[model samples]
Target: MRLGWYSDLNKQEKRTYWACFGGFTLDSMDSTIYALMMPVLMTVLALSKSDAGLLGSVSLIGSAIGGWGAGMLADRYGRIKVMQATVLWVATFTCMAGFCNGFWSFLPVRFLQGIGYGGEAVVGAVLISEAIKPALRGRVAASVQSGYAVGYAISLTVMPVVFAFLPEDIAWRAFFAIGLLPALLIWFIRRLVPESEAFQQVSKQSRKIDLRVIFGGEHRRITLISTILASGIFGAAYIMITWLPTYMRTVLNLPIASTSGYLAVNIIGSLIGPFVYGLISDYISRGRAFMLFLICQTLVVSVYMFAPVNMTVVLALGLLLGGFQGGLASGLPLAFSELYPTQIRANGAGFCTSFGRGFGSIMPAAVGFASTEMSLPVAMGIFAVSSYLIAFIAAMCLPNATGVDLSDHPASVVNEPSPTEAALKKTPAVFR
Candidate 1:
């Protein structure tokens, strides 16, 4: 029997959802593969913690530029085309990283890979947001974002096997090599996903790529607020997500196997978080949902970093922290998608998320720098809480746009449909 959000979608809509989901899953896998290898890279390459952190930051910087560029290109060209290009771009560079023997060689490769990684995120989110009906938008988009955890889980699960079977020098290289396989996902995307009807309709009617559209008049306030919100969330998220493994190993003094187990438990929570946020946002309001998550996540992360616990207790705490913080990961994309019109939606969403990543990208290097003076946990805790607080404040000022329609122009802010609204009778309940 038909039920919930999936029941409302047609076959092509379903395909679009899965294709974006798969793309995001692979994107997460390829982007984070470097983090998984950092410890090994440090040992074999004789590098320092700061050097490793700088490598991650460089990629995020590239992501920022690529995201903004691709978003603009997607508006001018098409979302699907940009998505295909980004996947191939990252896949090729990631494989080349595996072949590099030193810092100078790997730096350029990772930076290029970062560009594709950032582009994929913005374009894929735009594709899914444009394709889904308004009512199902939150749940569907959040579900796709949840694929980050799925991809993280896949990498975490495979790391041990790859490291164990292969020789030490080549094992880390193999992980990067495995990232190239996502290039094949482009085939499924090309075959199964169709162009967004909303995008196609709007593209035919609009020609200008006015970057100023997001910066002036009514959009000005939203642009600032949304960027701040993105900054806080991505800032806190990167600090914790990128460093948790190292934190466990260096601070808590856990072995590699134990660290992987802890991260795996955290991944399970990450998987559950987005769905929770989506359901709450759909039923309540997006602003309230963001506020709730930011507050809860702040507390969870603070405790996870500050509280002293046994290994079993730490695992339980990791799960809680992961669910809350991971859930927060979906808020910005969902919020950004609802804030702008179809004509410039990709550009607005892309700039906000990528800009935030650009701002937050500083955290890894900042944390690494601080680790030289203070405990890793303490340095992370300070930055994380600060970022979350910023997001909480921004969420308070954000407009409640849970049911906003993307297919319409700015003047017409349609409310959820009633039974008497003839056009919406066949639409989902949450939308109408």
Candidate 2:
């Protein structure tokens, strides 16, 4: 649990890390509940693969809107403010989703919740990305994402308890009602979390942070590539995660609650993966780190779906399955912040990642569509491996920014490491 990467952080940065880490963990927990409940929902609501896929896709589509709008608001108001609002927003809607009896009623609730989920992910990353020193940026910013695995592990542990005690139908509702717990984070944030200093500098200038800034001039390419990279990275993930529980239940011939052991291993691997990924990224470069994971994912997942292995072997493979998948997540959050300046930093990163969610959202449904023609495992494996391959190509195009200073100047989108280190040496020791 001890991380050398965090030792250098000041008190405010430490608080910021806890806030983002807590928020991202709960966000993963809340969002993951739907997937875990899929088997029951399908039976209760008379759903199909396509229906389940649509629900997953709908939340992500909502996230696309939420992430960008929250980013714009974060740019204007402040990161802490927007983050607080998002946490409250997600908690309210996630509880509401449990009340729905059918897909028609549940769809809109999921979308509204998606808005909060998407907003929390980007705003917190931006908050911490700006807080940490450049040398530790990739390691610190990306390691915060491991909170996703922590949240997922919580869900895996708690869901079996809910199912074991509650009535068959009501268990899912109790699972969702538990989601209301994340709202408690707001009090901690209001008391302890500080607004990003980078944002404070941007606010003092009173300049407008329009959406066009990211798409204009040299930034246009960065935005396009990051979006593509996000879609590929997250798309593959959504394909596997959105359908994983059901795949285990129906195809693997296990009960919904019974498969938790396998998933627990995967989640444990997920917890360990990002920390290792952060170290790799900080030392090697973000793009190279991504290339390594993406390639490994292609191989591991292929073996996961196709290898004629026994259950014991598959259980062990779950470790690698989760590790590579969890590791793939660090790139967008870290790179997006570095790809743009303070004026449009949140907006640009928001646009790329949010829209990446938008495009990636379809992959779950695509898996559903593909499943109609082939075995479900074949479909998921194809989509997963293909998505990573595409993302790997995008990684090749990424500009390295490992040591760049995150100045709030109108233009600090420079992606090279050395020039920014030299520039920082010439400036005041403190940002003021």
* Local distance difference test, each candidate: 0.82, 0.83
Worst 10 residues of 1 by lDDT: 411-420
Q: Write the per-residue lDDT of candidate 1 for residues 140-192, one digit (tens) a residue.
A: 88888889999998989889999899998999889889999978966566566
For all candidates, what are the clash counts? 2, 0
TM-score of each: 0.92, 0.93
What lDDT is obtained when candidate 2 is compared to the true structure? 0.83
- Can you tell me which runs of candidate 2 are displaced by over 4 Å? 1-3, 203-205, 408-432
Candidate 2 lDDT at 81 equals 88
lDDT of 2 by residue, 88-143 (tens): 89988989988999988989999999999999898888888888888888878878
Best by TM-score: 2
Candidate 2 positional error at 414, Å: 12
Residue 309 accuracy (lDDT) in model 1: 69
Candidate 2 C-alpha error for residue 418, in Å: 14
